[model samples]
Target chain A: MARVVVDVMPKPEILDPQGQAVARALPRLGFSGVGEVRQGRHFELDVDDTVDDETLAKIAEGFLANPVIEQWTIRRVDA
Target chain B: MARVVVDVMPKPEILDPQGQAVARALPRLGFSGVGEVRQGRHFELDVDDTVDDETLAKIAEGFLANPVIEQWTIRRVDA
Candidate 1:
């Protein structure tokens, strides 16, 4: 099987309330000397090796991600 | 600066409808020899090296992820 990964982070220009909220909360929670936590999501996938490149590319573009809000990269995890 | 990564996958027990739909769509999109596309996200960050481990750990758990629905890992994106 080939492994796939995708990540989605907030647009840089967009207000990242979650990241800001976390930044504000961290100090209160006893985490010192840390600031500006930008938050995002990550994914891991196991795909059958028989899957070819074109289809996986389609999957990444059409279904796996919303391009307006996020950017993604795909790679086969080497054995 | 240290780079942080987090990945979250749908629980295996839960149905991945997005994956199933992508699996179905790929063939229609003219990609052959493909099946079962599981999708997820990836993240890249440039974190200050002076930030200690404990704080980053807390960021991973408290802010970067929603542990109930996702699982995550963190590593320094080595220079």
Candidate 2:
């Protein structure tokens, strides 16, 4: 089996309220020096040996991320 | 400014319904060969030069992840 990692993040121009909330709460929680906090999604997939990188990319783009608002990267990782 | 990436994932033993739902949907969506899908959170933070790796680790552990159920890794990435 191969392990694939897909990280999906909001596009730079997109608004991320969840991230904003975290950024705003940091100082109140005694954590400082943080400026912008962008929250995103991470996925790890265990795939059969038949799965390839191109298929992983397809899965990331078509199923995991909304291309209009979020961008994603897919890479094979060590298990 | 420095860019920090914090990845928070559920402990291996924890149930991940979100991941399971995605896993179940993939085959129906014409994607196959995927076995286990684990979903997690990804965060990118723009931090001042004053913040160090240790501090970033503290922020990830204390604020970003629930220690009892999640594990997180903090790393510095080039902007």
Candidate 3:
């Protein structure tokens, strides 16, 4: 079995309320030096060796992420 | 400004319904080679040079992630 890691993030132009919430909370928590905080999704998959990069990309875009607002990248993780 | 990326993942013993949903959907989507799927949260923060590793970890645990079930790691991203 092979392991793959996928990272899904919002487009730079998109507004991320969750991130903003965290950013705002940071100052209250005494970490006033922190700036923008963007939140995203990370996925780890265990797959058969037959799964190729293209297939992984397809899965990431078609199933794991919203292609319209989010972009994802897949990388093979050493087992 | 320095960039830092934080990855928050569910503990290995915890149940991940979101990941399971994705795994189940994969077969229906014709990507049957996939196995276990685990979902996590990723955060990217822009911080001043004054922010140290310990502070980053604190932010990640206290605000960005739930330290109980989710474990997070922080890394500096190249500009």
Candidate 4:
């Protein structure tokens, strides 16, 4: 089996409350010098070796993520 | 400024409903032959140049992820 990783992040313009909450909490937790934080989704897939990059991209774009609000990248990882 | 990515994923033994939902949805959306899907969190951190890997990992462990049920990896990315 081939391992695939998909990183999906919201468009820069979108407001991410979950990220903001983490950013705000960091300072309270004594983590200083931290900058902006944006949160998104990460997906790991175990697929057949026959799956190609093109097919993975289609899966990421068509099902794993919503193209309208987020952008995703697909990469193959060692199993 | 430096860009850092923290990938947080649920422990393998944990149940991931969100991932299962996606896996189920994929076939309905016409994407077939996909295997198990695991979902997690993706975080992008913009930090000062002086921030070292140790500090980044600390932030990921102390603030971004829950060590008990999830595991996280920290890496630097191109700006």
DockQ of each: 0.41, 0.85, 0.92, 0.81
| Model 1 ranges with Cα > 4 A deviation | B10-46, B66-69
- TM-scores of all models? 0.68, 0.95, 0.96, 0.92
Q: Per-residue alpha-carbon lDDT of model 1 for A1-79, expressed as tens digits?
A: 7776655577777677766776677678876655455666554555678766665666667766677885666676752
Residues B1-79, candidate 1: write the lDDT tens digits: 5665655456666677776776677677766555455554444555677877776777767766667766666776673
After superposing candidate 3 on the true structure, give the runs of residues whose Cα lies further than 4 Å from its correct spot: none
Which stretches of candidate 4 lie above 4 Å from their native place? none
lDDT of 3: 0.90
Q: Is candidate 1 or candidate 4 better by TM-score?
A: 4
lDDT of 4 at A33: 76
In model 1, what lDDT does residue A25 have? 76
Model number with the top TM-score: 3
Clashes found in each candidate (C-alpha, N, C closer than 3 A): 7, 0, 0, 0
Cα miss at A34, model 1 (Å)? 3.1
Interface RMSD of 2: 0.9
Ranking, DockQ, top scorer first? 3, 2, 4, 1
Comparison by lDDT, 3 against 4, better one: 3
Each candidate: RMSD: 3.4, 1.2, 1.0, 1.5
Q: How far does residue A20 in candidate 2 sit from its true spot (Å)?
A: 0.9
Which tens-of-lDDT digit does each residue in B1-79 have in candidate 2? 9999999999999999999999999999988899999999999999999998788888888889999999988888997
Please tell me which model should have the higher TM-score, number 2 or number 3: 3
Clashing pairs in model 1, backbone N/Cα/C closer than 3 A: A6-B41, A6-B42, A7-B41, A7-B42, A42-B8, A42-B41, A43-B41
lDDT of 2 by residue, A1-79 (tens): 9898899999999999999999999999888899999999999999999987788888888889999999998888898
